[model samples]
Structure formats: structure tokens, C-alpha cells
Target: MPADTPTPDEVWALLTHLVIDTRDQWKRAVTERTGLPFSRIRVLRRLRPGPKTVKELAHAAAMDAPAATVTVNHLEELGLVAREIDPANRRQKQVSITAAGRTVLNTALATPDPAPASITALSNEELRALHEILGKLQH
Candidate 1:
């Protein structure tokens, strides 16, 4: 490879940094707009599809059982989530987001990010090509 070209490791490092920065920015924006903690937002996002048990929620949110329980308790107190005994197994609890929670999520997501308008400078063909490349990497 030419000395001027970046190595694969260098490219990966740049991509990793970009992803981390973007994610952190997004989390900050969400918190500022919604006043919800990141842990609660994480669980709320997971519950958008449907209700889930505490164990299932913990796994989805990458949290341990104890942490999930605490977060769920907080969300419950906020009226953002509700819990009920699982019909399939009375021993477990199913957690689901409330309508109020959905409203908060929608409001937070509707807030604009600080993405550069220069991204729109790319031509349609260029954007399509970039989309294809990103799609390939995603799979």
C-alpha cells in the first residue's frame, strides 16, 4: 500500500470514534429534551415493540437483573412504564411502556440533531453509493 493511504486499522479507529461521538451526542440530546435518564431511555427504546419481562428487558438493555429492577422502579414512579404479573408465569413480571412514555420518546426524537447540512451537498448518485457501502458493512 502507498504510504499516503491509511491502514485498515487506522480507518477502523476513525470509524469507531465517529460512532462513539455520534452516540454520545444523541444520548445527550435525548436526555436534555426528555429529562429521562439514559438507562430508562435504553429500556424504553427496547419496550417500543411490545411488553417484556424484567429478565427479557435486562438482556435487551445489556443490564443485569438488579440494575434493571431499579431502573424499572424509577420509570414506574415516573408513570412512564407499568409492570404486571406475567400471565404465562406468575413468578415473573412484564414491563411495558405507557402512552405517556411514547409521547416523551416521540418528543425527544423530534428534536433536531447537529448534523452538518453539508451532508446534503452530496449528489443523489453519491448518496446512493454511500448507502450501498454502509448497507454492505451492516450485514
Candidate 2:
């Protein structure tokens, strides 16, 4: 290790800061490019995998039912998502991303991430090391 290598406590602080900063940058980029809120984008992304009920979306998105419904309402108005009554449960509503939603997500993904470009400038060896470290940390 380098003599100036960060201590574990320093590494933890840096990681926390990096996560918050990256999330803020991502939110700015998504909003600037798509004019959609981060929460709505989150819902669309979650729905991209498959149809889900409003409650499911709420739970997954860390939102309450009413908040999820509000977000869904706006997405529906934009024609980016659709809602249908669940056949299995009359009281439930299933939400699914529309073709337009996928297109929007694709466009957003294609947008330049507004985070520090320096992160992407890392050498291949550094990138590999970072990825390996993160993978191990996750478990």
C-alpha cells in the first residue's frame, strides 16, 4: 500500500461522500435531460423489469402509497406509464412502463453523467481494483 493510503475510517467517510455526490449529480443530469423528477425516473426503472402494483412500487421506491400514486399519475399523463386494474385482486392496480418510458430511460441513460469526469478517467488497472473492492464490500 502507498504510504499515503487512506485509513479505513477515512475510506468510509470518502465512500459516503462519494455516494451522496454521485447521486446528486445523477439527479441533476436526469432532471436536466428528461425534465423528470428522480423519484419518477426510479419508478419507471423499477417498472422496466415487469409490471408491479402501486403498493409494490411504493415499497420498492421507498415511498408511501399516496406519493407513489402522485408520481404514477404524472407519468400516466406523460404517456410514459400505464395502470390497469389487477385481475387477481380487484382492489389493486398494476403499473407498467410503456414503450415511451423505455425510450425515455434509454435517452436518460445515454445522457452524460454529470458526476466528476475524473472518476471515469481512472486507469484500467485502477478501475478493475475499484470494482473488485466494491464487489467484495457488497457481501
Q: What lDDT does each candidate get?
A: 0.86, 0.88
Which lDDT tens digits does candidate 1 get at residues 1-139?
Answer: 8999999899899877766666777778889989987778888989999999999999999999999999999999999999998899999889999999888878777777765444467899988997898899999
Evaluated against the true structure, the overall lDDT of model 2 is 0.88
TM-score of each: 0.77, 0.76
> Which pairs in model 1 have colliding backbones?
none
Worst 10 residues of 2 by lDDT: 110-119
Q: TM-score of the candidate numbered 2?
A: 0.76
Candidate closest to the true structure, highest lDDT: 2
**How many residue-pair clashes does candidate 1 contain?**
0
